[model samples]
Target: MDYLSIANGRVLYILASIVIIVVIIQSVLFLRMSWKRGISIGISKTKLKETVKTSAFFAIVPSIPIVIALIAISPVLGLPFSWMRLSVIGSQSYEMIAAKIGASSMGIANLTDPGYTAQVFSNSMWVMSVGIIWGLVLSIFALKKYQNRMKIVQKKDSKWAEIMVNALFFGMLSVFFGEPIVSGGLSLLVLLSSAAIMLFITWIAKITGKQWIRDFALSVSMIAGMAFAILFSNLGAV
Candidate 1:
């Protein structure tokens, strides 16, 4: 069977389009509700509009990665599923890893190889969808209790609670930072370079009082880091 046909079929496109439309509708509804609530609570319309503009700008910067992710995985999973998965819930790392596992489990050595089949695609889809839910399930069942406990801790020892919260935040970030550092090489170099670029951009933003430059910091840093990576690789620096 031509699995790519099914993967990129009109049916899949329709399904993905529907899901995307629903998400957009929900976002619009939430924005309208929040805007109205803010106005009711005495937020000036000018301030609210500025907040929305800033938020939309930040949102686009983050989605640059997601667009790249969609392009990266589309060959393996096809455009529709990859588009839906990345647009909805799955990250690039998770989707790629899950798809690789699924394909390899079926004895496929290369996902983008021409011999990929419908069975492998189906299995990868299932794994990608199911694997993302365990953490969400834990949160649904336990997050409320955990939050209540944190509230109690905050009331009893505000400073300690703040420390604990910061620790947890950093712990969550450790996963993102740990991988590049462990890989050591271009990954580490790029990571450090991006950090430096972000700091430099931030300093410029502060010195110049340009809020828009601060808003562009992460996106600019990432692109510059990629350019440096290519230059380093060409120079045999990995």
Candidate 2:
């Protein structure tokens, strides 16, 4: 069996289309629910509408990397599976790592090996899907309780709650960036350039008093950082 033929088959495309439809339905339902809840809480319609617009903007903007990743990995994983995986989870690094590990386990040497088989493709798909199941399970079961606990903390001591939330945010950043930072060289340089781009955007937003532009800071910085990495790689600057 051809590896890519299986990965990008019509059956897989159909399945991916179904997932996309389900996601759209879910997004609409959640948006309606949130809008109603906001109205109930006396949030002005204008503010809520603005919030929706800003949210949509943010969603599309930050997805640049996911689109790039989908293209980048399509050669190894095929377009349909990569599209579906990124659309659902949006974890580019995790999916790539899972797929590579799966391929490695099959003794393929690497994802780009010419001798890849349908079995290797199947194994990679299974690994990518099953490895992320725990996060979904926790989201379904623990989210409500976690939300309630945070509310209680905030109600009791807002200052302490703020500190707790910031701590969580920074802790996540450290974990996410720790490995790449320690790897040094190109990864470290890209990270610094991205941070610099974000800081520059924040300064522009502050000095210009156009705070809305700050929302795109992450998107711009991420794309620019990727561009920088590509430039450095091509120029043999590492």
Candidate 3:
């Protein structure tokens, strides 16, 4: 069968649904265990319930963007694969970039480009999987050692270590925020607008003592940023 047909195939959807079901089962088990443990540790039932409520609320808010991203990618990669990838280890940005690289390597410009076949789709999936597999494997094997090394460095010079950690965070932030600015289009506007919304949300949360606002601040800012992007696109301002 051709790539487009495979993308929307029933078998793929069934497999993806099975993976999701497994994940759901695991999550339910973990939650049950954690709840029992919390009770054993003398946590009150009310407090435990509240904790679950807050977690569900916060998780739902952040997951909106992820769902949006999944929808955005579904057309190109097919619903089942895109859903599975995002639900598992793949971040939206990373998946998009990996798919582009995979397509380019196969002489296709992008995921949506013509002449893409089932083989091409398989190649793209392999590329995406292989690209991310190393980090997961390394973390499973070496993360504790890496963390221990950081702890040793911190013990040797706590102040210097703090500075180093902060620098690393800022450097990562710069890369994420700087790329859109360098691209100089709707992306730059979206970045700036999101930053502004986040700052405003933080300020209002602090002043108003609205804990819920603080909890949902990131989600609100991201939604606002997306709205601004749409408006700008409609206005041809970007």
Give the alpha-carbon lDDT of every model: 0.86, 0.85, 0.86
- Report the lDDT tens digits of candidate 1 across residue range 2-112: 898999999999999998899889889999999999999999997787676666765775688889988899987899999998887677778888888888888888887
Q: Per-residue error at 168 for model 3, in Å?
A: 2.3
Stretches off by above 4 angstroms in model 3 are 24-69, 103-114, 154-163, 179-210, 221-238
**Model 3 whole-model lDDT (C-alpha atoms):** 0.86
Candidate 2 residue 226 Cα shift, in angstroms, is: 8.0
lDDT of each residue in 100-204, candidate 2, tens digit only:
889898998888898688988989888888897897799999999999998999999999999988999999989869877888878888889989999999999
lDDT of 3 by residue, 1-238 (tens): 7686788899999998998899889889999999999999999997777666666765775687789999898888899999998997788789889988888899998677776778888888889889988887999899999999999999999999999989999998888777787788999998889999999999999999987677767777887898999999999996
- Each model's backbone clash number: 0, 0, 0
RMSD in order of candidates = 3.7, 3.8, 4.4
Question: Weakest 10 consecutive residues, lDDT, candidate 2?
Answer: 211-220
